[model samples]
Target: MKVLKPIYFLLALFLSFYPLCSRGEMSAGDYYIYADSVNTGGVISGGDYGVRGTFNESPIGFTTSTSYETRGGYQPMELGMKVSASSLSLGTLSATAIKTASADAIVWSDAGTGYTLSIGGVSGTSIANVSDGIITIGSEEYGLSVSGVDRAFTNDRAIAERLILASSSEPVTNSKTTLTFKASISDTSVGGSYSQAIVLTVSGNF
Candidate 1:
């Protein structure tokens, strides 16, 4: 009986380890909401202020000349935005991309309308519903600053270069893309001033 008991214990131990050894590993399946970390890529394209069209300093305010690239690392990239200020009230707002001198410089042609800055959302995702909200600051409301703020409202009717992905048609896969953002305030009444920094949050599977 003692010998039999010892054999039974040995069999039980082997059975316990057999399943573990034969266990199957996991496999990533299709259509997964892959929560990949934020792999930051690319620097902002334009930043040097130039006088071109509208101002005595030049029509173009500050032009960011750098083209943003995808941050090195993972996939399934998504995009988000934030404002440097809690609120933004301004004048004739507008945004434009920096044009290179090269006649054949292939710049993005589809400059969608500029969208509004949110606490945590995108301004324009659809072509028809592009609205960054227009604000008319009277001469009295000049230089109005807001806090907890990290974004601003733009008069420019164009999509932010950073939020503009390489493929907006569907499941975002491409990682190597350039982006930029430019804005200006021309509220004549009070000599308008824009407040807050606009920061973007890009995330997705990577």
Candidate 2:
């Protein structure tokens, strides 16, 4: 009976460990599918991913004569511009001028005698819009109305106050636009060689 008791104890121990060995030998597929059901929670929302974008603008190539000879009459000068823009908001173009002297005195000490600079243009882009009337800048206002068409350009220090020569919300790639700057001087104006630096600015929103 003592020998039979030892044999029975060994049999019981083998039976207890048999189920554990079977569970450890489970296949990879069966273990993953049956082990706690892998709660994915649908899309697994988190801030680990994101979306982004970018924009670019090419230098506005302006071509024109370096000097102009205004012989006391309406002397018209022209410059051409080609714009390449990648933006979602409207692209804007403007020009502002600063004389060597003052606005009223293109030539020093010449009160009430100065040359007038005006800008105008026709857009090459079909969807682009140009100013149609005299756009005012600060206290000064100028007109670019010519030939029954009101293609005007405003002069101001503020970019918001400046005129929009050409604009469109869509991207403009190498769009050709012609800008005509007409300078008029009266015969009684100062005799010195007067000059003004005209600054052209272009911007696009993204």
Candidate 3:
């Protein structure tokens, strides 16, 4: 009797287990991790020297030195620098000469006739041991040229068109002399960055 009762009990237990493990009706849900987060970041920046050109608004003047071997004393000299306005011009903006003040004499040697006038570095003209002076701004040349106007009369000359020199009391000597070159700048002159070096070489018979 007990064995017959156990058979029905076992059948009931199987039916209950089947419903928990395998169901005909569908039900769904997502499971995920719980999280807390933090984040961080950074940045950087920097500048420098820019491109520039030379602006010789006024006469830029300086001097060279002269030394004598068996000289009794020393002498001072005078040299003239002239700015030539070449045909090159960007509209009304033209290139002008920047003349530095008189520098000391650079001596070379004597030709038996006289002392040879020499300079360290100079630009502009074709300088000989006896002739014109060469004053340069970087690669720019400054020699004698018509100020784009007439020097025949003073009144006809304009500032932007000529370079005027002050009155001189003496000629070039062994010592250094003051020299100035004047010019007129235009409103149309290009505005921006600039830089340049000027070199003046005065050569003559001392």
For each candidate in turn, the TM-score is 0.26, 0.26, 0.21
What's model 2's lDDT at 47? 45
lDDT value, residue 167 of candidate 2: 41
Please report, in order, the local distance difference test score of every candidate based on alpha carbons: 0.30, 0.30, 0.30
lDDT of 2 at 162: 46
Error of 2 at 103 (Å): 23
Candidate 1, which ten residues in sequence have the lowest lDDT sum? 99-108
User: lDDT per residue, candidate 3, 104-198, as tens digits?
Assistant: 22222222222222223433322111112433332232233212111222222211222331222224223322322322233444344322233
Q: What CA root-mean-square deviation does each model show from the true structure?
A: 22.2, 25.4, 33.5
What number of clashing residue pairs does each candidate have, in the order they appear? 46, 0, 25
Score residue 39 of candidate 1 by CA lDDT.
Answer: 30
**Rank list by TM-score:** 1, 2, 3
Per-residue lDDT of model 2, residues 1-206, tens digit only: 99899899999998987764444222342222112112211122224532222112121234335684333211122222332222122122223431111111011111122112122222222211123333332212222222211223333221222444444343333333333322222333333332223333344422
lDDT tens digits, residue span 15-100, model 1: 97775344332123322212221231122222452122211222223334478433332222234332233433333443322211
